[model samples]
Target: MRAHHRSRLLAATAAVCALSVALAGCSGTTKKDSKDDAKEKAQNAKADPDAPLKKGLKIAFLPKQINNPYFTVVDKAGIKGIKEFGGKGKEVGPSDPKASSQVSYINTLTQQRQNAILLAANDPNAVCGPLKQAMKQDVKVVSFDSDAGKDCRHVFVNQAGSDRLARQMVQDLSRQIDDKGEIAILSATQNATNQNTWIKIMKDELKKPRYKDVKLVKTAYGDDDDQKSFQETQGLLKAYPKLKGIISPTTVGGAAAARYVSGSKYKGKVVLGGLGTPNQMRKFVKDGTVKEFLLWDAQHLGYLAAYAGAALASGQITGKQGETFKAGKLGKYKVGKDGEVVLGPPTVFTKKNIDKYDF
Candidate 1:
C-alpha cells in the first residue's frame, strides 16, 4: 500500500511539472508577441501618418556658391540642424552662382533618389525644370536665401518678407545718411530676385516724403563678383563725385565696396553701408569707411532652412498654409499662405553690436 501511494505521488508531481512548463512556455510566447507588437507600433508612430515612410530620410542642401562664407556658414548650420532634427544631408553648390552649374548638381542628386532638395537657387527659372522633374519623381524641393520658381519649390525660407527687408535696407542707410544724400547701389546680378526685389522696395521707400532728399544716382551690378563690385564702386565715385554714400546688398559686393572706398581717395568722403557679414565689415566699420551694415544671423538662416526642409521631408508640416513647426535653435515658425518661412527681422550690425557677434 505504501509503494502504491509513492507511485501515485510521483504521477501527480509529474503532471504538475508538465503543467508548469506548459504555462511558462505560453507566457514566454505571449511576452514575445507583445514585445514585437509594441516595437511595430512604435515604428509606425515614428512614420508619417499622413505621408507614410518619411522618417530617417535624406535631403540635399544646394547653396548658390559652396566656398562663399555666407553659404559656408549656412552649410555648417544645416548639418547641425539636420543632426539635431533627425535627417541626413550634405551641402553642395556651384563654384559660382550659375543656374547651369546647379542644374547638374540637381540632376545627379535626383538620380540618386534623394528625398528632397533644399536650394538657394542661383537662377530663378533655370532651376524650374530640374526641380519640377524631381517633384515628378516624388522628390521634394525647398528654397532658401534665394527663391526659385514658386511652383517648383514646396516652400521658401525667406530671411524676411520681401518688402520688409527691402524697406529696412533703405531705411537703415537713410538713418546714417540723415535721410538725404546721393547714394549709389552696388547690387548683385540684375537677375537676382532678392536683389531686384530689395531694390524696388528701396526705390519705393526712397520716393516717400521722409526720404525725398535721398537721391539714388546709379545702380550697378557686380554679378556677385568681387572685382566687378570693386570696379563698380570706383565708377560710382567717378561718375558721382557728389556721392555721399553707397549701398551694396550682396555680401561679397558689400565687402568689396567697403575695401575699395577704404583704400581710395574717397575714404571717409563717402559712407558705405549695406548687407554684409559683421566679420568682413569689421575693419571697414572701425575705420569709418562703413558706419554700419545690416544682416540676419546667416548661420541661423541655414539652421532654419534645414529645419524647414526636414519638416517637409517628415511631413511634420506640409507646404500648406498656417502650418507651424519647431526649428530647434531657431524656435517655431509658422508658414504663411504662400508656404514660405520668414525668418526674423534684420539685425543691424553697428559699432556697439558688431563686436558681440563672431560670425
Candidate 2:
C-alpha cells in the first residue's frame, strides 16, 4: 500500500479504536465480565487440558450489521459450520451499523460470557476496548470482513485486500464505460474501514496514466441502507448527468443503485457495477441495466471465520502468518501476516456465470 493509502487505513482503524476508548471511558467500569471469564478459564485450563470440550460454548459471528443480505449470507454459513463442528454459533449485530451500537453489543455479549466472538467491526477499532476486555477474560476474539484492534483479536479472516477488491471494481466499471468518461463511487458509511480502504485503492488506480481519460466526479455515502443508497444513486445521476458509470462497493448500495437505475431512463445510459447479491442483481442483469458486478461467496466468508475462531479457541493454531489449519470441506488454509484467512478471489458476476452461483 502507498503511504497515503496506508494512512487512510490506519486513520479508519484509529477512529474505531477511539470510539471504543471513549465508550469505555464513559462507563468507567473495569472489564468485570472478562475477569470472571479469565478466572474460570484458568481453572478449567489447569483442571483439564482439553477444557473447552468439558463446556458448552457459544460463539458469535458479529458483522457490521444484521439483516443485510451480505451479512445474512455470512450468518447462514456460520450456522452451518458451527453445527458441523458440534459447537453453538449464531449471527448477532445491531439493527443499524454504528460504532456505538456495536460497542453495546460487545459489552452485552461479554456479559453473557460468549466463549468466542468473531467480528466484522463496523468502525475500524470502535469495539477494540470491549474486545480487549474479552481477551483479558479469556474469551477468544477474532475478526472477519473488517478488523478491530490487532492485539485484541487473535485472528482476522479477510475476504481479500482492499486494493484487490478496489482494482477489480475499477477494472469492471472502467471496461463497461470503455475506460473513458465520468464515474462516481456510491460508498457505504464514510467511516466504514473496508469501504474507505477500497475507495482509496480505486482512487489510486484511477490516477494511473492508462485511466487518464476517466474522471472520478465524486463519492457519496449511503450508510449501507437500501433507501439511502437508492437516493444516493439518484443524487449521483442528478449531480453528474454525463456520468458513464456508478460503482458501489457495498452490497446494499449496489443493489439499491441498480434498482434506482432500473426505474429510470438512464438504465442503459449509465453502467452499474459493484458488490451485490446475485438474487438482488438478477433483474438488472436481465434488463441490461447492470453490465457486471463482483462479490465473494459471503457464506463461505462466515464459515471460514468460524473455523478460524474454533482453531484459536482450542489452541489448534495461533494467528501466526504461514501457519495452516484444516477447515474440513473448505480445505487447509494459512494465516497471512495480519492474521487474516483470505477466502479467495472475488467472483465476477455476469449473466452467463451468475446462474451458477446461489449466494
Candidate 3:
C-alpha cells in the first residue's frame, strides 16, 4: 500500500508540474513577466515594512487555546526565538478553542500596537475580520499550525506539507489494519483549518486504488478537550462495531483517544495513530494500544514561525514566494507559493524509537 501510494503521488506531482509549464507556455507570457507580476502583487499587499526589522520589535503569539500542553510547549519555543532575535514576545489566548475566542485577543494586540501577531487560527474565516483590521493597523500577522484566510495573514508557517501529513496518516492506518476495513477520524475541531485540510486530503487519499478496501466510517470532532475527546472516541467505537483503526491528528485528541482505547475493550483490537508528543503517548505505545504515529517538532515549528513574523515586521520579506529568512538554530527557510513556510517532514514514532523524543 505504501509503495502504491508513493508511486501515485509521484505521478500526480509530475502531472501537476507538467500542467504548470503548459499553462505558462499557453499564456504567452515570459518567465520574466510572471516574476514581475508576482512582485507587483507582493508590493500591493498591505502592511509590509519599508525596511527589515533589525531590533526592538514586539511580537505576540496566540494559539488556538491557552494553557494547552501542546501550544504551551510551542509558544515557549516561540518566545525563545523572539528573544534570540532581540524582540519582545508575549503569549496570550483563550482557554477554549472556539472560533470566536481569538477575536478579543487580536483586537487587544492591535490596540497595543504590536509589531507582529503570530497566531494559530481556530477557524479559517472567523478571525479574518480582526486579522484584517490588524493588518490595516500595520500589525504583521503570521499564522502557524492553523491558518486564517489568505487575505488576512501575511504568511503561514506550516508544520508540515498538508498532502504529506494526510497521506502519512492514511498509510499508517492502512498498515495497522492490513489495508482493509473501517476507519474513522477523531479530529480537533470541525472549523480548525489544519484539521479540515488534512481531513479533506485523507478523504481524497481514500479514493485511490490502493485504499479501495479501506472505508472511512465517520469523522468526529472533540473540540480539543481531553474529556470530550475521550467521550467522542467512546462514541465512535460504540457506533462502529467494525472499526479497524482510528486517526486523531491533534495532540490533545490523539492522546485522549489513546487513553480511552487503552482502558476500554478496544485496547488490543483497534489500532490508533496520529499526531502526538512522546511524553503523552509513551504509555500507550508501551502497552501496545498504538503501533505508530507521526508528528513534527512543535518547538521547531514555533521557532520558525517567530522568525517569519520578525521578517515580515522588519520588511525583510513581504510574504512573497522565494523570499528567504534565517531561523535561529533551524537554518534558512524560503516561502513557497501562497506565503507558506514548511518546517519539514513529520517524524514517525513507534515503540522502538518513541523513547528518544521528549516533546
- Compare the candidates by lDDT and give the number of the best one: 3
Worst lDDT run of 10 residues, candidate 1, spans: 34-43
TM-score of each: 0.83, 0.84, 0.86
Candidate 2 lowest-lDDT run of ten: 46-55
Write candidate 1's Cα lDDT for 24-133 as tens digits: 54333442333133223322333232443345678788988887777788778887777775677788778887547799989988898887788888788788788777
Summed backbone clashes in each candidate are: 0, 4, 2
Query: What is candidate 1's TM-score against the reference?
Result: 0.83
lDDT of 3 by residue, 1-359 (tens): 99999999999977877788855642445554331343345457654434555798899999999968999889999999999979999899999999899999999999999999999999877898888778877788899999886777889999999999998999988988999999999999989999999999999989999988999999999999999999999999999999999999899999999999898888999989889988899999999988888999989988999999998877778887887888878988888988899999999998999988877
What lDDT is reached at residue 269 by model 3? 96
The lDDT for every candidate, in the order shown, is 0.79, 0.81, 0.88
Instruction: Identify the leading candidate in terms of TM-score.
Output: 3
Model 3 residue 154 CA deviation (Å) reads 0.4
Residue-wise C-alpha lDDT for candidate 2, range 1-359, written one tens digit per residue = 59999999989987876778745532445534543453244323421123243124589988888978888888789878887778898878898987667888788888888888988888866787778777776678888887774566777887876678889899888987889999999998877768878888999999988799999999999998999999999999998989999999999999999999999989789999889889888888878988789988887888888877777677665566666776757987887876667888988888898888787
Pairs with steric clashes in candidate 2 = 16-125, 16-126, 17-125, 34-137
